[model samples]
Target: MTAALAVRNLGRDHGGGQAPALDGLNLDVPAGSCLALVGPSGSGKTTALRLVAGLEVPDRGDVLLDGRSVVALPPERRGVSMVFQRPLLFPHLDVLDNVAFSARVAGASRRAARAAAAPFLDLVQMGGYTTRRPGQLSGGQEQRVALARALAARPRVLLLDEAFTGLDVALREDMHELLHQLRAVLEPTVVLVTHDHAEAAALADSVAVLSGGRLLQHGDAGRIYTRPASVTVSRLLGGRNEVPGVVVGGEHRSALGRLRLPTDVAVPDGPAVLLVRQEAVVVTGPDAPGADAAGTVLAVRAAGARRALTVEVVSPGGAAVQVHAETSPGQVFTRGERVGLRLPSSAVSAVPPEDAGTEEPEIADRRTADAGRMPRTHRVASPAVPDAGVRPDAPGAPRRRNHHGDHGT
Candidate 1:
């Protein structure tokens, strides 16, 4: 299958003695599929999208669209449409006209443009708002119309730059589902740039993690989330357990405990870090002992549908390794209380020390020293476990909802 969009060894420099915003980054978006680009601010994610859209040319390498090198093409000729964080609509144009602007600009008659834009508006369920002007429409409505506008352009690839950032949770989720459905029916290759992992995990066919102007990792969302390539990728996905340790005497001595590495790295015996996901840390007690367990609960907070319990586990050297566990309704613990925590064989991952920054240990990691030795092992409650980050504190959690209507991710 031909790639709908491709970037190879792409780099760009802004020319003021700063590093290139985009360093030798490469990625391919299969036709009729969606890839989510996620990273911290200033990670060059938007720059990459602009490069693919032909809004900006790379300083090196190339961008190919539909198997053709379109680096020299203008934005209009690149066969792509971008929906930015804020919907850019013509103030004087009504919804129908805004949605039809692309076609109109391409020499289609006003009547023809409206006719062409109708079905696209209907796709986003904004058909009835066609008569309203941009200023008269709500933020979500304006975005829906923007989607229609982008679709009417008949682009082979669609770029969304945090398009739903200003909407409420319910509206944002609705847009996410709408985008997926549109992709399935329209069959356009879509690339969504977002900082929210939950959004990426929910909407993307594949996710690319970008940092420091480089593509850190790209793969199926589930696999990437479960097994991130490095500590950065793990943390970017909202992982709470990043324990830096060293491989000594064939054992990985982490604050949690000294355990043999499940796999070997090319790096010979030295300091390393373990990237563990909070979901992988199972909370246990005397009644429910766990493997390589050692920790005392530091704090626990009810997080919407699940509870977050922070624990500090001790390493062999008495250093602290803080880890968080998502507990279910029946499972609960309190601060300063000893609890068994389990790191399933599949949960622990070891990466080089450089990727794991030496920041102040989280509250849970500090309590690991007070934790006891003599680890306990617990049996799996359900051999077959079927289950289910961010975005506001939700209704139950303490959070401040801003007037701009943006929620935490």
Candidate 2:
């Protein structure tokens, strides 16, 4: 079961703070699709989730499901359910009873609820564990049962608050697969709160970015990742290189050289910030064909199957820029080795230096697939998840005015 969700002017104040924990948040989740709320800690991702779940009251705003306001409804009557980070299963109850708890609350007999919950338990692959107590199940098993419990209730909208955060990498991947399966078959409307960019990219049809209790940007998952609305949003999505530049016509030029702006994006003439995703940059031997810049390796660190490097690039005019990049784990570069860089035009985005709050969130909601409109499942990819960095609030850094000798590496 699924229903569209609308959040209008949602505001919550924890008090004693400079800003409300959640302020004027607006989002729309298409029936049977998923939206992810992403940001740093205290960005109101969880606060928004709680408000929508009716677990907490909003200081202002209205929550509408399928166009009907549910503000007066208690949590139990809201036709929604939440799955928390921890399984928090009842230690004494067996798996089957745990999943049937909601039905039991609704006045169903134990035998009737258990029988009704059998299929949901099977859906999560825990049917055989019905007699096992929560304490006897593994962490992953407990979560699976928890998910079953939430599903057995037939919620019109499901809220997941870091439900997979505590799981190990392998277990998280397993849960992601299960969720994909559930969405494909059940098509429940969902709002997920998580700090994990990769998780959001993998699961959400759309992404809503928030910071300082204000909505920063929201849009299609791909748009949010490839073309962030501001430098803050780009950094949140893990875009590393912020090349200060000027846009003349549609082209952007920085000290490093030129970056072809996306044709679909109309960048105003004058100062702009060219966003180069860290993964979009490919390092090669100095003087390699199509090399955009030359740089000398400053540092390198290998972690598991990925290698990270800090490189300092020098221009012909003696300007220097530090860039961060990643390469295959097996590829090795010495600290002093010189390298060439290639930044694909398609991977670059341009945003005005202003970096203000988001435009109407309708742009995000407008892109959502209409109710009963089946969307593709399991779509997931992004430019590398680079290290987070501070926002470059101001733009138009120094640039080279004149060219001299050969371009320096």
Candidate 3:
């Protein structure tokens, strides 16, 4: 299939204390496909989208549409539509008028614009809301109208920048479903910028992970999440239970024990870190066969649908490892209870320790340039897992962890 949008060697630099927001990025969005850009706040995911929307231009590289260059096109001339984080609707306009705004701006007569927008309003399940003004509509309703407006223009591509931020879960799901359905019917290329994993899992055909102004990995959502290219990508995609260990005998040696690896990945022996998704790190009884016990319970808390058990590793020098599994909070044990922690080789991705953060709350950088020439293997453990140290002030931000033996809450 021809890509609806193609970006090549895209580089946008805003000189400051910080590096370029995007550095030599390349991506392809297939026609009728939805791609989700996910990363930390400063990763430059939004900047890429804006560049495509013609809201900003790249200092280097080009943007293409249907295999043709559109880098020089103006926002309106490029035939692209964008919905910002907030629904910037005109309060005085009724729902239909709000949705028809774009078509009208494009010189469609009022009657023609409204006629063109009616079917789209119905498409978003907001058909009857046409007469209500923006002030009378709820947040979700306003967003749907905004979506309708964007679609009414019948652009070649649609850009959504954190478009569902303020809505509740149910509403967010509804909007996600609406976008999926519209993708098939309208067949516009879709690019969504979001920090929400579940949103990316639900809506995207592919996931592009960015960090510190560079793309870390891009592939089908399931593959990218299950087997990340780097430890940074794994952590960003909600994988927890990172274990610091060494590579020996063609396997990864963690405090829990050594597990054989499938790929060498050229990671040298000695100090290294292995990343395991919480779902993959199962909890077995202390005496269970294959149990590579290491830690004692520190704390356990209710984690939404499951329990988050925080344990302090007594072995490998006492850093903490937070493990989440299918257990009840009511089944909690007191601190200092001996427990067996097992990380099956298939469950963990052995990455260089250099990719792991030294402290909590620090953003991971994916840029290969300027990385340390020497990879060190330290005998360290996190007092609390990096993510657990996330300040309450920064929601959805990365936290810190000690690698020695301290696990996090």
Instruction: Output the number of the TM-score-best candidate.
Output: 2
The full ranking of all candidates by lDDT, starting with the best, is 2, 1, 3
Model 3, span 1-409: residue lDDT tens: 2248999999889777668989989998888888999876667787888788776789999999988998887676677877765666666678897777666666778899899989999999999999998788899998898788788767788888778876888899889888878877888888988877878988899999987778889999766776677667776786655678788966876555567765724567887777766665656566778765656676665556666666655546554545544354345555567666676555657677653344223333322211232212112111211111111123322222222432110
Against the true structure, what is every candidate's RMSD? 11.2, 15.4, 11.7
What are the TM-scores, per candidate, against the unseen true structure?
A: 0.81, 0.84, 0.79
Q: Provide the overall lDDT of each model, using Cα atoms, as 2-decimal numbers.
A: 0.72, 0.76, 0.70
- In model 2, which range of ten residues has the least summed lDDT? 383-392
- Model 3, position 229: C-alpha lDDT score: 75
* Error of model 2, residue 339, in angstroms: 1.8
- Candidate 3 off by > 4 Å: 1-3, 16-18, 263-270, 289-294, 313-346, 355-361, 364-409
> Residue pairs in steric clash, candidate 1?
255-314, 255-315, 322-365
Which candidate wins on lDDT?
Answer: 2
lDDT of 3 at 181: 88
> What tens digits encode model 2's per-residue C-alpha lDDT throughout 1-409?
6899999999999778667989999998999999999875667887887788776699999999999999778777788877876665666678898787777777788899999999999999998999999779888998899889888888899888778877889999999999999988889998887767889999999999987788989999977787888877886665667777799889888777776787977779999988877766788989999988889998777645866777898768877777777876577888999998887777778888853455233222322421122221211111111000100121221121222221100
| Model 3 weakest lDDT span, ten residues long | 383-392
Ranking by TM-score: 2, 1, 3
Cα TM-score of candidate 2: 0.84
